[model samples]
Target: MFRHVKSNLLLFLLFFSGRIVHAQSRAVSLAEALQFAQQNQLTVHNKQYNVQVNEARLRQEKAARYPEISGAFDMRYNQQLPTVILPGEFRNLPAQNIPVVFGTKYAATAALEGNYAVFDPERKYNTGKAKLQENISRNELLVAQTDLALEVRKAYYACLLNHKKIKLTLGNLGRSETFLRNTQTLFQNGQVQPVDVDRAQFDVQSQQAELQKATLNLNQNLLSLKYQMGFPLDSAIVLTDTLLLSGERQAVFLPDELKVEARPEYRNLQLQQEQENLLLTRNRHNALPTLRLYGYYGSQAFREKFNFTNTTEKWYPVSYFGAELNWLLFQGFLRRAQVQESKIALKIRHNELLIFERDYVFQTYSKLLAMQTEQQNVHVREANVQLAEKILNVTRIRFENSLVQSQEVTDAANDLLEAQTSYLNALYDFILARLEYERIQGK
Candidate 1:
């Protein structure tokens, strides 16, 4: 009896654990979807790394302005002492040629060195250029983030639209089945012809086919949404948000003025211009001379038998400080060509900025017009759907009262479905246009 109880307990625990795992895949709202994509998208990660790389480069350039300090230890063993010819008077010998060896078999030296730039125009310009490049990288990261958010929102809305389509199709299929059943009952009572029954059957089959197609399309859109959100494709996800036409219609409006400078692309272009100016400055400064200050302090030891470690052995101290001036008298006009190139680049960027500003204004105006048109379309489609629904209801009543044929009722049902589909499509377009307009405004 104890073994039987243990087995049941184990089975219960296994079932409970599976439920917990399944529960982890909960429904996601639009806000949660956007947040998840921001955290998980690979493109955002790569852009973030690019910003870090630029920061590191800026630090490297700044370090060059400060004094550089280094230390070293070097040792040498003389296999053969250097030989030198000695004068006869110095050696107290005859004037005949004589060669003698110099002193130590082992030598060692330790030194500390330091260098500081006193004046360098090119280095100063390069530091400024590095700072501008870092700003450019930051703006590029912002661009990537904005683009990803827009893509996620678009995909999310598409999924919502497809979900709505499937619901409408399923509802129509249910109504079609009811109509077929009513037609069959009338035919059995000898009130309707056999062809009428066949027509109702055909209507039901068409609706069923449409429902199947809609279901397939919905699944495809859900997969696309998952891909945009960086969610695992095999995982189950339920979208908790509903697309309402009323909320979107309230957001349509035209701004009095567009802030072109607020966009990251515009800022990036401005940064490029600044960088080119700095480059031009650096090239012109390259012609000027550079001045640097350097100093070193060290101790040298020499021993005949590696006895420098002995207390009695003496060491020599060497110290010096000096300044250097390096002037490039000529370099085959390379500096001149570089300066010209930078000048041309700066001019090109200036023109690009103007072109972009003008184009941005035009696009904003065009999108505003499109939003107005879509807003009108939504109203028209909404009224048409209501009208179609009323017509379908009247046709059903007439069929029951023997005032119309079953084919007329089927035609009315198809018209209602068409109207609803058109309405959903209009809503989809309006929502996307609003999203794009908001993005352009940098909201």
Candidate 2:
């Protein structure tokens, strides 16, 4: 019995301490979380591999401009058969050696060789191709970064919006409880009708249901934010941002001239154009011949004894140095076809790029208009929330002074709660719309 009692006490103490710890825990801000993800997220790992892959490709391309060196050694054994025609002057090849190498023979040689390209137009364009490939890889990584940031921002704002909903729901529930108490007091004094008390009780119950739903929504969005930020399991935090739609706020819009020149999409297209030009140059260069210098030094030795007269004791040193031009006289018109194919692809990409620019401008223009409209909505909702608050306060005072019906107080409370929620939603929508605008513009 004592042991069980002690365990119960220990459990209570632990639960109480956990509550204290939770109360003291600080919330991680958005910027700090973003920085952590940059260093720790799985997407960063993928981007790192992408950079490494392009780096390897660049190295391979640059290596094409250098000389290649290689060496090899070979050893083999063989057997030979011979024929005899005359008795004394037999047509047998070296009768003594024929018997010596009758079953198996051994020969070995080792050599080192090298080749350096003296002239190639393709190599010149290859250098440029490698650099442009690096640029494309960098842009791709940036796109990933921007995408991840956008996801984080959306999740963060969602959590903020849900948190505001929870607060509004709780406030409504409290108001219901207070109004129910006032209605009961009035009934005890015989000032209000019994239906008034019933309606007030109904309001309290409805607000309780809404409060529960709002809490669930808040928890779900918290889970989403945790997933987006890649936080560890069991992390608990409360949002610290204020939930209010600003009444008067404005953004400085960029001019059309500056917007087109500074956008990432435009720069990406420009990079692609340069890369295609380099490829065309390479295809054109392929029509020319190539020149290279090849050299090798080798020696073959088979000297059982250092006797110069013996056939088995032969050793010689050999060296070679030469330059060669390799020209494909014809490939059955394949080269011409390839060049024409490349030219057509280049033109296609150019046309696609033109279409893309037009679409980008249209999209930017549309997003700007959407953001402006959302801003106006935010202002209207903010004003409504403020006015609703005043009405709820005045109605509550009048009910307390026996100057209003319980239904009037209930209506005012509901209106206030709805107004608060609408304003919060508008606040979230405006922020998200602006973020989308900025993201698409590559700000």
Q: Output the number of the lDDT-best candidate.
A: 1
Clashes of each: 0, 0
Q: Pairing residues by index, what is the TM-score of model 1? A: 0.90
Cα RMSD (Å) per model? 7.4, 6.9
* TM-score per model over all chains: 0.90, 0.81
161: Cα error in model 1, Å: 0.4
lDDT (Cα atoms) of all candidates against the true structure = 0.83, 0.73
Writing each residue's lDDT as its tens digit, candidate 1 over 194-298 gives 998888777767776676677678778878888988888898787888886565676547664789987888998899888888888899989999999999999
Which portions of model 1 miss their true places by more than 4 Å?
Answer: 1-24, 85-98
Scored by lDDT, model 1 comes in at 0.83
Model 1 poorest 10 in a row by lDDT: 1-10
Per-residue lDDT tens digits for candidate 2, residues 1-443, read 34335434543664476478569754767776676566667886688788888888889988988899899776554344334344432445444332222222555567889999999887888778878878877777777777778887777778877766766776676666666777788889998889988887788777767766776787788777777777764778655655443443555455344356456566678788887778777877787999999999876654333343456565566779999998877778877777788788789778878887787788888888888888888779879988997898788789778898778877887888788878887888888878888776777
